[model samples]
Target: MDVSKPPFGDDDAHLRETTVSSQTVYQGHFLQLKRDEIALPDGGRAAREYVIHPGAVMIVAVLPDGRLVMERQYRYPVRQTMIEFPAGKLDAGEGGLACAQRELHEETGYRARRWARAGVMHPVIGYATEVIEIWFADELTLEQRHLDEGEFLDVFAASQDQLEAWMQAGQLTDAKTIVGMMWLQRWRAGHCQFDWQTVD
Candidate 1:
């Protein structure tokens, strides 16, 4: 259905908000909080606050047996251990595919010989300007993992059926991982296709 293309049409002029003024409220290592005064479509002024994040990449790595490589880690903000696809934020000036490759190898010790970019997702559209680029990887070879300092996660493999079961049983709650599963299912069902690239 070509969901990436949005029909902005003439309604955009009526719904768009123009930035009047913007200022940084807080700046972290890679995240920045900004508050902006915006001009509403109805000629009203309002303030909008949001977080600016360095975009990230999520990898849906698959084994030869079709099991998906996954991770379990504790998220401090949510105070819960979450299962997710291997993902990481982009370093300054880093490309999406590079980040995906690095993250998959670092976290899961798997280097993919074939890769395909699926699409991008905005996980937190309301309060954060964070976009995650999704990639699918196969022909994986296990290697030594080099997790970043203080980063801790357990890497495991699960079949698509297991993932679906978890989702239905309220266990798989990671939005990005769920989206990856959807893409995987659609691709497997021939509803969509990926332009696979062989990586050295």
Candidate 2:
């Protein structure tokens, strides 16, 4: 053990896992499964398997009436419908903000005039490199929605109080949406700030 170097230190001396080799075990339409041989910090080697994602974006779309646009969609893997913010995976070469705009309009039929980046998160850091960019959208206008073929979801609006209550009652369990709600609470309470921008 290196006493001078801590695991969370600035340098990589204490926590270095070098990838000796990598192989793609499976490749799907939007995800790739990879297995890698890594040299551990100690004198040992290990095999790690994970998924590769194209990244994604989540929108906390707020209406002028102090309500949020939310969605209820069935998640196949979980075999249940979940309440979540409008979100979608980024297309190849698409910017984060562009993806957010596209998903919001496609899912909720609303376009936002004002946009702000809230933050980024890794929902599956342990097994996947899926990064989701969080965005706040406001000053919205009604627009025609174009959901992807074979997609079905119910879009609705909810107040902050209602959302908080749902969360407390375990009705809201989506990780990204929970994070977005926390950001919203912080922003509303003056505990956090956002860099607002105008969408063209």
TM-score leader? 1
lDDT of 2 at 7: 70
Tens-place lDDT per residue, model 1, 54-173, is 999999998999899999999999899998989999999999999999999999999999999999999999899999999999999999999999999999999999999999999989
- The model with the greatest lDDT is 2
C-alpha lDDT of residue 25 in model 1: 98
TM-score, one value per model: 0.96, 0.94
Residue 200 deviation, candidate 2, in Å?
3.5
lDDT of 2 by residue, 1-200 (tens): 89746777577766879899999999999999999999999969999999999999999999999999999999999999999999999999999999999999999999999999988999999899999999999999988899999999999999999999999999999999999998999999998889999986
The list of candidate 1 runs beyond 4 A from truth reads 1-11
RMSD of 2: 4.0
